[model samples]
Target: MTDTLNAKNHSIEKYLRQDRMPHIWCSGCGIGPAVSCFLRAIDRAEIDPNKIALVSGIGCTGRVAGYVKLDSFHTTHGRAIPFATGLKLAKPELKAVVFSGDGDLVAIGGNHLIHAARRNIDMTVICVNNFNYGMTGGQVGPTSPLEARTTTTPYGNFEPPFNLPYLASASGASYVARWTVLHLRELERAITEAMIKPGFSFIDVIAPCPPIYGRMNKMPLPMDSMHYYQEKTIIRHGADPKEADITLNGPILAGTFVDIERPTFQDQLNHISSKVNAQV
Candidate 1:
């Protein structure tokens, strides 16, 4: 067991802050695997780690920035996108990535998220949607399914959850996709693709929050949620984002919903700047 543990540690040490071992995520939490897949995507993308910047907001997923060895920023709650946007605008050479949870990205910082997409900012946003607010006592969040029970909604969540892919596509994301943590290979591939893609790229990753969200929903074990994902998820590449809404115990539509080219915010800014300089 010691040898196995040492070998595992040795393999992933390069990507992590070794001093921060034994993360705070609960047992059966899916954030760890999502982070692992992200690191693998970084490796697969083959971009210089020095040229990458990771920004995250407050949440279980936000803790990702603290563990990664790269240039990472733990910003204010729900402000990861704006922070990443600033980083990208200041140094357009850097590949900025916003890693945060659904509650942080879609609830508190939702306005920034929509505008960032509307402007077609050059960044990769990886939103880990675990249904409820895992970090803040499992309150009902923007992505919590209708009728799902949360700490704040003991009776049941009645508000319609946002179809994240649809929102991204409608807001003008150039590349949008959705996948569960169970689909590691596909999720890694999607992340790799998003990292290399220009303009606003959004990937909604459905991860399990076994401790809080899961227990409240009768899925106490992580494997149960993973199994649920395996059984309920439908791979529908290029499907209309509007049809991707997730309902309580409903079939999950997962795939790349949009991939197209458009003038990025930086590109347009540079063009306008050049024109202004020429006129002057």
Candidate 2:
């Protein structure tokens, strides 16, 4: 058993800070699988791990940076995007990736998300949406389905959740996609594509918060949530983003809703600078 465990560890150790083993995530937490998919995607993309910088804010998913062996930053809450933006601008050669949870990215840092997308910044954002803030006592988040129960919304949530794909598309992201943790292959493929894409890319991962969100919503087990995802997910590769809004126990449209080319912030700036210099 020890040999088997060590062998399994050896396979993934190259991408992880093995000294930080025994991560704090709960059993059956989707974050583990999501992170695994990301590592695999990076390998598949064949980019030098040293050239990739991972940035994450405060949340369960934010802990990803701490565990990753690559250059990573665990930034202040709701500030991962801005930090990543600065990193990308300062070191354009490095591939900056923002990996964080829904509440940290969409609720407290929503303005940053929209503006970053609008500017077509060169970066990839992987948002794990578990319906609530899993780390901080499971409070209701911006992506929580309407009528879903959370710690703050004990009775049930009434506010509408953000249609992440629609938001990403409307904000001018060059690449946008969504998938659940259960869809490992698809999620990894999306990540791999995003890594190679030029402008802002966003992938919304619908993960499971079984310990809190699940228990409150009649899905106490992680497998139950996975089953729910399997049953509800509808793969539509080119569906309209506006119709991808997720409702409680409703069909979830997952796919690459948007993939278009646009000049990145750096690209536009360079062009303007060259023109000004030529005129001068």
Candidate 3:
């Protein structure tokens, strides 16, 4: 009873900038759950909130920076990764995080995403994938599954959706995982693991955009989307990322695909610096 009342009394109030209350996220939007999980992960991991620097690009998910009670940046569309890269390089001790939507991170910012992973930058990237550009009129986007309908793709999306897990794995992320908003506990744990891990860590959070993408794609109700995720999700740890492509109503692969130790960009830079100093 006490725990329930405490939570009712706004337990999560501390992590949020209350002045920004009444967030813009729509009812039934999965972004709220994803953010809640991230906050819980920080608490569970016992991370010093002050030591974290969050960066977000222009999109629905980008608003996370404004709400989080921490040092954060709301950068231009598709520039979140580069900003985070600079922050990580300048302050290697502080954990850099990039929180953005599919369109902002993997669409115009796709180049930055792959290069950061390739360099193994010490940062965490949380990508909220709602299959379409939820905020911007629900257009078909890079992550829109094949044949999925959107405002732009009224009939169906012919272009093959980017297999995010495979792309991240191939580009060389140190840690990668995918989870639906329905898997609350697993999602929280994954965020915690990603935050604690070194090198470029990426999380693909498959979420629902009920009024727009979901309604257009036949998941008119939020519960419809939730049921679909519950029924279709496949938990396969260490599975090959190549086979984790998400098609319309296909088996959704959810798990950590990559968790390997690799030299981060900072480590390489330091090594070269040390070598140059030895010759000097």
Top candidate, metric TM-score: 2
The lDDT of model 2 is 0.94
Worst 10 residues of 2 by lDDT: 1-10
Off by over 4 Å in 3: 1-10
True lDDT of residue 180, candidate 1: 95
TM-score of each: 0.97, 0.97, 0.96
Clashing pairs in model 2?
none
The per-model lDDT (C-alpha) reads 0.93, 0.94, 0.93
Score candidate 1 by TM-score against the native: 0.97
- TM-score winner between 1 and 3, please give it: 1
For candidate 3, give the lDDT of residue 111. 100
Number of the candidate with higher TM-score, 2 or 3: 2
The digit string of per-residue lDDT tens for model 2 on 42-101 reads 889999999999999999999999999999999999999999999998999999999999
Candidate 2: deviation at residue 252, Å? Answer: 1.0
Model 3 C-alpha lDDT per residue in residues 195-278, reported as the tens digit of each score: 999999999999999999988888899999999999999999999999999999888999999999999998899899999999
lDDT of 1: 0.93
